[model samples]
Target: MNPRLKHLVVALSLSLLAAVFTPAHSADTKKADAAAVVQLQQRMDAAEKHYRDAMLAEDEDAAATATTSALAEMKAVVDACTKQRGCAVDTMLTTYERLLKATPQFDDGMPAADEDPLDERDFTAANVPDTANAASLLSEDGQRFVKMVQFNPAVQAGIRRWLTDMRPSLMDSYENYRYMQAQMAPAFKQHGLPEALLFGIMAKESNGKVHVGSRAGAVGPLQFMPATGRRFGLGNDGSGFDTRYDPKASADAAAQYLSERMAQLNNSIELSLAGYNGGEGRALRVFRDTGGRSFWDPDVYNQFPAETKDYVPMVIAAAWLFLHPKEYGIRWPSVSSRPSTITLAQPASLYELTICLGNWGSRDGYLRALRNLNPRWAADDMLPAGTSLNATFRISWLYRFNCAHGQRMALAKQLMASNVQSALVRVGEPTPAGSPQVAVATPAPSAAAAVPERKPAKPVKARHYKVKRGDTMSEIVRKFDCDLGDLAQANKLRKPRYALKPGQSLKLEGCKG
Candidate 1:
């Protein structure tokens, strides 16, 4: 062949070879990529499922964690694609969009249709205004108070929001507030403040939950920050319990704080609420800068944070509802607020009690009510026998019928005792023999060989006891008839404040028959 033709022939053969092999190699790579995409998609689906499950469980913290993890996984897939050739960005993007679409969208202030409706009749009987006239609902003082507070479009919108989308939360706040009214209202009354104001602030602050603490280090039903709480005599009470968590104490402090703010701001409740939600210093500064102008004054209002602006109006709206529920067609559920006490006949936790009590008269179970009334005790705390807890008359009645030593109580106890760990076995491990099978020399037939009577093992009384579920130090001391002081000393426990955990061992010092 001619040299030029030979060279052309060689080049064409090489090009054809490249064309044939390149596609085969590309196909293998594409297959691997496809598998990888499928695996990543499966992970994303699993993470999305976990997030949905957590949200449905009402576990906001868990849902947040799951979201973070899922986002990280999606980012990993994206990063992996960037490092590889021929990665279908559109495919990955589509997968990402699908994963995001799987997340359920939650509408703020919206309740499910099947969600139990709040029994508004409770608040209606006591708080519903007579005559349905706004004027008739107000006293001379209330009239003046209302005039001082702004009821502009913003406030009206807040009221509508509360009555509509936020109705469930509003009702929940009312129910919780009623239980604490006896404890909180007197403080406001003593300060010559309206009780409605107290309820309004509480509804906005912690939803009337006494033990709630805010992210800003504010603690208790009133959501007082640490420094502010200390200023109002609401910090530690020498018993490791913050007085801020005490409904009466916190309410008294809140009343005092409000009174002080009112004094500084011409007794304007709006400015006072602004100060309560926004920083008091900022409210005071704005008030001084505006030369004691109204909180609704654009100049002064704009100075406060968005939260405070929303807060002042919402609080007023809630207070308005508290005073004029009938006009608005709001009927608060008539909860059994009559106070009572129940002494546990046997060991039980609040969880067990709530289960056995059954929601006979109440809408939900008595767990929240019980927990609110007894904030010092945890819901899962295994209460000792004979532990007397503060409760309502309704709870007392339910306890008598359901929780006082019967089939229900037994079932609850049995349920509480179920050990999932005991049921779980090692996946591939063989079960161990019950008794070691060993052969022994047979000297048993000797006539004189009577195994020396195992001197009846002298009954060794237990000198120490391991704490069991539902065991408390007080109950333990009582059970063993031990002196409290000596028992505490023996166990190195603090006096009058001993806590016992399951599996903890305690010495029976000074325990006598």
Candidate 2:
């Protein structure tokens, strides 16, 4: 044993014995002992430092030995503290936290500070338990989910779709889910549900976009209806923020809902999924009517609506692909998603932060990650300084080095402050030669200044716009930020289908900018 570790063991043993045998002590004596406990904490820190050094030096033998010594020391410290009076155990827990922070990236054969932690790994080391080999990296529940897959023609067809045209969506869902895995996966795990199942449901429902809403009135990554969401405690929290749009809360509700369905539906995943998509009442009725037959039984399957029929197989296929992406020649993007946070040094919006972050070490910017992690804030909402934003380790790091007091930061600020209305020029306005085209709003005259009589400004008239190729009425309305009814009325376009053809002329009214 190392001399420092041996000293830690002896100190802990003496402390435990004293705590057990001694009946009482003065306040001063207790305070003195607490101080001694604090001193003992240094040993654990030293052990961690040794472990980190060994890992950094690529001495696996030394690193393994240090790990064993450190864990034993931690256990002993915890044990002694439980018995020892006035031994502030928080000191010990903080030491353990530091060890955890250091240990996660090292177990994957990389240095703690330098490695991204997501490259060529199933999950962060902290997430996977007792992972002896690469194949065992999937949590026990994940393996169970893989075994549950029935691989029928519907699932096979779904898999073919995922591998072909839908491949981009599959990749995007994986990337989005990875960032939110820390927030969402644990709920399913706590309910003894599979993490892959959560991913599958999220992928099929919203492609892991938390704010996504369906035309059918379903919302969030899980696509819960308003009634179902309210049942699962996912509605408004009274501050106007819908909890369904919240990843962690929605995932918890989803897990609980699934657990209830599993209990009522005889633990049948397919039937539970059908209930989730079609209707729980319908699913229960079908199951009871079929004498608890397999979901594949035509009697049970035919009862579900066409949408539910397609939904179940697609979700299953996505889950299958999530677990076996490599088997089908699909290489998912490597994402660094270790949970971290950043306290804003100055007010900024997600859009500004995304611009400043500038896609460093990512194919796309961090806007999606920011939105998914901090769901309450809109992309363009400027969060105040000292606001703590949930982020990834890599993103926080980028914010520190790239986003603080840089040219890119200034540019981001400038871009967000700009207004498109300032750039617009009326069709009949005279062009002034040698005048700068930039439109600057003049400041209003001071209240105390002598005011001159001013003529009333003319009301701006409707502008004429030509219909372009491939332009739909809805698209044109959205592009011009026009009210649909007002736009239709101004252009004399028909109701319901306000159709348009190429090269047609129309008046742009009820539009801003």
Top of the candidates by TM-score: 2
Provide the overall lDDT of each model, using Cα atoms, as 2-decimal numbers: 0.72, 0.76
| Global CA lDDT computed for model 1 | 0.72
TM-scores of the models, in the order given: 0.57, 0.63
**Candidate 1: tens digits of C-alpha lDDT, residues 1-513:** 999999999999999999999999989989987887676667656755664454443233444456556756776776776665666667766766765533322222222333222222323323422111221344643555566677788878989999999999899998897677666767776776777788889998888787776657787888988898999898767865667777878999999999999999889899999999998899999999999999988999999888998999999998887766666877676565656678999988887898888775567878888877777665656789899987765577567656774578888877665443333344444533552333334454565656565666788675989999878765665467676668878888752236577999888998863
How far does residue 366 in candidate 2 sit from its true spot (Å)?
A: 0.5
TM-score (C-alpha) between model 1 and the true structure = 0.57
Residue 142, model 1: Cα distance from true site in angstroms: 4.9
Pick the lDDT winner. 2
What's the true lDDT of residue 329 in model 2? Answer: 68
User: Number of clashes in every candidate structure?
Assistant: 10, 0
